[model samples]
Target chain A: MVESSPPTRLDALLDQLATDLEPVKPLDDRPTALVLAGLFAAAVALVLAWLGPRPGLLGEDVQPMFMLRSGTLAVLAVVCVAAVVAQAHPGVGRNSQGWKVAAAMAALFPLVGAVVAFTDPAHARAMMMMPTGWQCLRMSLMTGTLCAVPMVLHLRRGAPVAPERAGLLVGLASGSLGALAYNLHCPFDSVVYIGLWYGVAIAVAAVAGRLVVPRLIRW
Target chain B: MTSDEATLARLMRESQGGNAQAYRQLLGLAAPLLQRWFRRKVAPHELDDLVQDTLLAVHQRRASWDPARPFLPWLAAIARYRWVDRLRRSALRNHDALFDDISVESGESALIGRLGCDRLLALLPAGQAAAIRAMKIDGLSVTEAAAQLGQSESMVKVNVHRGLKKLAAMVDEDA
Candidate 1:
């Protein structure tokens, strides 16, 4: 049987579209860097305006554990931003090593906290449920919300093949940024408090991203 | 990747930057693949419509393509979505016709039925009518209709709801 030539309509449509086509501006080569900078800047501004940085952030009394907490959150934020950018275009990061790296970083803080808590058995229970855990959760979510708007706008500019995945990355990135910002103000030096409360806030942000991204970026 | 894939990717990137020639070339290259893809599932006559629909979707969503990624996968995903949407609409059209046939047979004269259908559709603005046709008569999901119409999903849903409500009001007045 003669296969009819592929329809001419495609040719006509292409011709029509070509006639109206406008030159597209070049995409930013490092949108992830730009977005990360934006998120950090937003978070820092919020920190300075509302809750000043931790009193001892630069003082000699600053604990070593505080660095670990903030450092881990920063790593998560950076890795998640990379993954989100990778996913902004579907099929770009099929291997998705970035996500695995982000996940490992996310796990590290909690695992280290658990180990430290075990070493100090008497204070373990109290540190596990800090009195200000809710405050951390709220502040982290607020920070995530602040960062999410700009991140989502950036992601929307790209063609994300998987809206859910794209949104998830946005949420994770935003949540991490939020936690990083909250860390500046959070006084609790206990690893357990940082691990549990910051984790909750990031999870909430991730879930929110999953729910909201698909709708916002559908083009 | 093959040279063709690399060329396609370059074309897509260039197209994104407003090179009309590259955009045309990219679509030209994509058309055959889309035709083959759609032909596997749909009738021969419906082939052009599906191909056109997929191309339109790609045009609208082109900004989402990442320059670093292979272009074929992005194009393939859009084609696949449009094909599945066609299958869904085909199924719904059949199902709706079964019920619509009963109503047409029961009371309305054939001429009146035709007039009523045309008149009701005409009552709506072009955008609303197109939305109603795709969503109501054609059985497309709101997302599917939105993509086809180049409108947001919410806008499609709103148009369909409002168009149908108005049609119902008109029927009541006629009665």
Candidate 2:
């Protein structure tokens, strides 16, 4: 019986498989979307604290400075972002404690935000209605949250589908969604410039999210 | 009230019967696993599309899953098919058996394709090949891959976090 030439070695086999995929670019700039979001979340919360409650609908009464209270919620959002990032990482939940930590953090974002908003809504009202940059900041904050939403959704779905343009997609969704949802209630200031269509500007920030989140996380 | 044999297994069964609640539950249950699996295979960015497609497939063909079997194996089959599809699109579809291809090439040029990637690649969960392909070959910015694939950039980042480690291990094994 003729024996075939000796089979190739396994070591040699894998060596043949390597190609110019290159080491991932250093994570220096990547994955910043979440961190910046966290930072922004905290910053927005801080601004609200200084500004005092978010505005009420239809321009109701204003309230006292309640930055500290809102700060708690903002802090909670940052923690939740970190924890969610961790939770989203593989194998962390198997440890049980990691799951609890992540769950707690996730639960806390809205929880703390709600508690502060309810316990002393004046700050939320003030911040919401300030007419100053607060409105835009609030919008940005919400936009960030929206951007994060799909990522969380993607994770829960359990397949890494973001093969390309993750940050851009996030930014676009956030920008359009934020603009669409918020612009509905826009004061429009009687100029009726809605036709001027400035809402598209929000896409820039969403684009930023697309670039930033992946780098920091380096997925 | 299905007792846990892992979250997806129970939900997969219920979802097959067209239970939206069960399907939603299955989506949640499957999400993290899919994220981790895809992350391991590809860059952090591509994860979003991978998850999106997988979920859409699961939702679209929920009936194909047989609850009588282990959820993971079925999911594994789904994942494997996805990987193969991706491999064919990229350059990694293996025409030769692992043993057969080992000796045909040499030199650093050939070394790119010949590096003991299989040893380390096998060490990783099978799903991550897609991730590796996106980052390495397709030259996608992680953000681009993440958005296209419908996953968190961070999730994608974490999945490919260990390439250097895996490579190091392979190098050590080779030595």
Candidate 3:
């Protein structure tokens, strides 16, 4: 049998590795998963923003419960979209040397905004406009967490995934989850704008993923 | 009556002048460091081959060894390049392994290296915990790790970094 060869499995592996192979070369997905779960909160911010200012709180804090700020909403959306694209294609666009750039950019947006908010909460608050700051942060955190979950799984899988498809899946899943959770805080009296619109955006992205994922997958 | 330094210098000059004995002595002196370096990097199976390659390169390019320069650094440089070449050549298949047979310093005589284990153990997830133990306790290379876990080399490396980062962060956080 082939198993009975003089070279043991490790011997063969080492022989191949020494003669030919080569070397070249994510984060922990669990915390990212829980954080991802917060995209559900992306719901409350987007919906309330467009529905004219319904400031509801997640907790009992009735101090104008405008947690998911519009700025955060946009950040979450962009991150979600990036995640979707990454998921769809997996490793496709990565070796381009610009992946670190994209990753830095994706990671930078929130930190910059957070710093901006810290510098001048009043002006920052004014520019942020929507009473959705907390919600939006939660959304970004959630979507990041959510998209990161599957991405972690993908990394752990170690089978090559199409980078673009990976991104798409990340974005769509994060978006949808953000919409659904955020919607729970929706006030029945006013129309839930984000709950409706963002939900549709995420759903559309998911369907697009369906199309893209198929194309991305090897036959 | 020549000092080791003079003898070493003479040997270097002689090796450069194509003295096979001088070349052999230079290689004899350099072998330990190269072997150790390669041993840390590759599977047990690949370690000798790589070390041989490193020595062969050193011999082939004997002129590159500047007499004014300290020898170890030059040899280390050779080892590093050889290591990089090995990594690049195996990029596709090895990309999935985690540690890639790099021997951890704690591996030998690690049974006595009890200082970091308790704290390190506190930080690791299951797989990383095991890896640190194997590297520290059992003294296996990253390739042996793949064999142990039935995973890829890149995956092993990834896990090691993640585990290491976590361990480092835990130490920092604790501090």
Candidate 4:
């Protein structure tokens, strides 16, 4: 079946490849990937249900600050997930700038916390001494880790040109999802606590993803 | 999209649907295009292997392509990834003779013609790019590269490794 007047090795190889070809389902689109990631969210919900919601999340008296923070985290996690999904298909989605903007917006929580700490010595000490901060950190990371498993597995299904960035996105999305999951149970709503604990947890998750995910997903 | 691009997209759509003839035609057309693409980026001796490697990658990763999108950019992205990967491995292997006396004829096409070593190097940090340029492209000894760049010998090695690593990570973005 070689058509060239003088067949080359590549033509032979090409023929071999074509002979072995079979129908393949294309990789999942962005929505499908998001839904796959969402399946893990149910695990987060189960854990939250076991732990019990932050006492009053469902009640009318819930703080608007809590709603605002949780909303921000939810949006950030979705954006990160979308960005990571785009990584699987090269040239399909090249909007690397989208996640950066979302990340910057998310950073404002920690930035405000830093400003509060630096500007007011008394409140800074109170924020540092808060008893539940470490617990929030642990739970957030645990939640994120749960979300991360499926995301990593999802990324492995395709060829990611930037494995490191994709790994980081996996970490960020899962970490934020983790924070959101734990936010339903966490009692602390202060900008200082959320900033310090959630920020560190997400940062740790992102760093861990960057370091580890590439090795797992590299093609 | 051009007529060729449209034809390629159609062929790929057929290939995904389990049409072997379309797949063969797709690969047949793709092989020469990849050869021209890699010509400017790789040594002449390495060109054929790189093209084959890329063709194989395209076959392996064909599922990642969406029928709605134009085919060439996806092909280009995969090609760039393979090119960077080949360079990274070669850089790690430290094959001194591979790059020697390398000269490439200019390619006639659009997207592939724009890529060259200079453009590839520009993606890295200045320090890393300089180190790769001296040690890999210029074939300088580590000691010579260190002296030329005015840094410790250890730094040159570090920069080259980091540069190659960064190049692999950034390949997807170039498309």
Candidate 5:
């Protein structure tokens, strides 16, 4: 056999890095997704049992619209989670498409809300701002903070090429899940409140993620 | 897809399992490829250093590797990152200080008097090779080289740096 090239300082560095190396148990995305889903479910259940769904949600006329709003929020949560997982692996193409899809969905909610509020003319201003706006924002943020813990932990297991992007996705995921949970407790069925407050909550989490992820995930 | 790649993947998998021997063997196997890759981007004297940096990065970040994915793309991404880092650092180096260190006879004009550069030039990427030919071998200024190549002056500087680095690697390899 041909002799290998003479060893260099790289050999030493490699040895140093590999010393006391333990086998890494591979992190699968499926389990992470399940855990996030379970956490979101638990949060929603707790909120429902404690405060109950919006008072008028049981009525026939309001129930369908409430279900529709909650369903949209749930879909947003799932998409954000998928984006977060996709960004965890290095060398995987940047999940721009996933981000774009999430953004479109996010944008769609607000645009639809604006149209509905303006057309009604009766409650447009009232729908735009509410006394409970601050509460909704707080609840969403609280939910996001709780959910971000697991999301960040899962992200730490992988080599992310873009930490900021990964963080933003994590924030979006957690924030949306938080909004979904908040939706269970929020009695206001007005599209304006849901669109504006929920959007801001997600944005806050995303900005926080962008700032925190690079530092948190750096190897 | 190739057997070489398959073998490399196997070695990486073994290395991830805390196999030092396999890890060492993997680094050894990676050296020449890393050398060639760095050569196309940096100078000869810097080649070994960049290669070492890449190796260290690979070692430190090895845990992030997914066994399900092919190994080379992951390694390439790390190498590319290191290359960009080196370029950024080089750009920050004091140019006047660098110029003062070179002897008059070792300037581009004198260096172009030699004929052996063609063989080495052939080994570089097209953009870098052309940049070197116009700026170094032909003794054109950066502006002239940029105009001749229809590229930005900064781009010409980058190409020249990368080409010279590759030529230095060839000399070192031959030596």
Candidate 6:
């Protein structure tokens, strides 16, 4: 009788894995998209239930600035969420540069606001005198929190190569979603108000995500 | 994608569907690739363990792979993540072992140990080299090294740890 050599450790591990293996559904981008959509719908619904929409929201002559602000926030939220979702699938040629472009586009809001504020003294004074600006900041952050929690939970399912980047994206996504929801009820449409308060709120969320998210999703 | 990658991707897709034979074959191919990838990044003693850890990671995160994408990059990313994780773990271990136990005795053997380290020390920052030389080669205690170097005791320890880590990295690169 011929005797065979012992099975090596790797062989043993492989056999064990194969024995324990079960059918698994491949991860797709759709589930993440659906999650984000649901969250947005919920946030919008909550806003409508808790605080009524700004007067003339459904009117024919709705403010152009309001549309622009909401549209920018919507785009930012979608782009950031997409970037975060892409982290789950690791690939060499795959890149998530869309979020950066979206972020830059979003930056235009604050930049134009800053330019307007500096060039026009009256606008600057108007921004400074608005007492409800802090309320806008608080409300935006609060709304962002609604999105950030579930988004982080969803992110935990995948392995992100750069945890810090994923975290930052999650924060930005949530903050934008929050800002978008808050925009429905926010009566102030000044470029300065949107730029300073909304921008700060999103920046704070991104920083917080950078600090906090990596710790939760490391591995 | 290369033919090899196409085959692997097909195998992966089959494995995801509970095809044990395909899954086993995929892992069989993956093990050697992981070994070669890890060989350059880790010591010989750690090579097998790193390969196995990466294989286990690949198994656990298999679902993370998007079918439409090429397979090799996804595998490479997972391997890179493991390599980094191993480096971090070793650094932490070294940090914890910093002040465990040391005898301040000098002899010919110690001199022999110091012979080749001058080259290594030269590659480090001046402060780090000085701290490493005082504490490691000369067999000085942390306090003694700090007093001799005119740095704080904590700074001396920090420099020695950092210097040792750099030396390890240099050796790794050379290997």
For candidate 5, the per-residue lDDT at A121 reads 66
Candidate 5 wrong stretches, greater than 4 Å: A1-5, A15-21, A56-62, A92-96, A117-122, B1-3, B42-46, B84-175
Q: What is the lDDT of residue A38 in candidate 6?
A: 86
Candidate 3 residue lDDT tens string, A33-88 = 44444533444555456443434444465433134433444455555544433332
Model 1 segments more than 4 A misplaced: A1-8, A29-32, A92-95, A111-129, B1-3, B41-49, B66-70, B80-175
TM-score of each: 0.67, 0.28, 0.28, 0.88, 0.72, 0.76
> What are the per-model DockQ values?
0.17, 0.03, 0.02, 0.55, 0.17, 0.27
lDDT value for model 5: 0.68
Cα misplacement distance, residue A110 of candidate 4 (Å): 0.8
What do the candidate models score in CA lDDT, each in turn?
0.69, 0.42, 0.45, 0.79, 0.68, 0.75
Q: After superposition, how far is residue A192 of candidate 6 from its true place, in Å?
A: 1.4
Ordered by DockQ, highest first, the candidates read 4, 6, 1, 5, 2, 3
Considering every candidate listed, which one attains the maximal TM-score?
4
lDDT of 4 by residue, B109-156 (tens): 564544333566787889999887787556677888899999799999
Tens-place lDDT digits, model 2, residues A74-146: 4433343343332222221121223234324434434554566666667646534546334644664465555
lDDT of 6 by residue, A103-179 (tens): 99999988988999998988878887787777767777787887787667666777676677788888899889888
Candidate 1: give the TM-score of chain A.
0.84
**Which residue ranges in model 3 land beyond 4 Å of their true spot?**
A1-219, B1-7, B94-175
lDDT of 2 at B123: 63
Tell me the native contact fraction for each prediction: 0.41, 0.00, 0.00, 0.63, 0.25, 0.59
Best by DockQ: 4
For residues A4-69, write the lDDT of model 5, one tens digit per residue: 557556666556656745666555788888877788888888778876787766676667657877
Report the candidate with higher DockQ, 2 versus 3. Answer: 2
Best by lDDT: 4
- Cα displacement (Å) at residue B44, model 6: 2.2
C-alpha RMSD values across all candidates:
14.1, 19.5, 17.6, 3.2, 9.7, 9.3
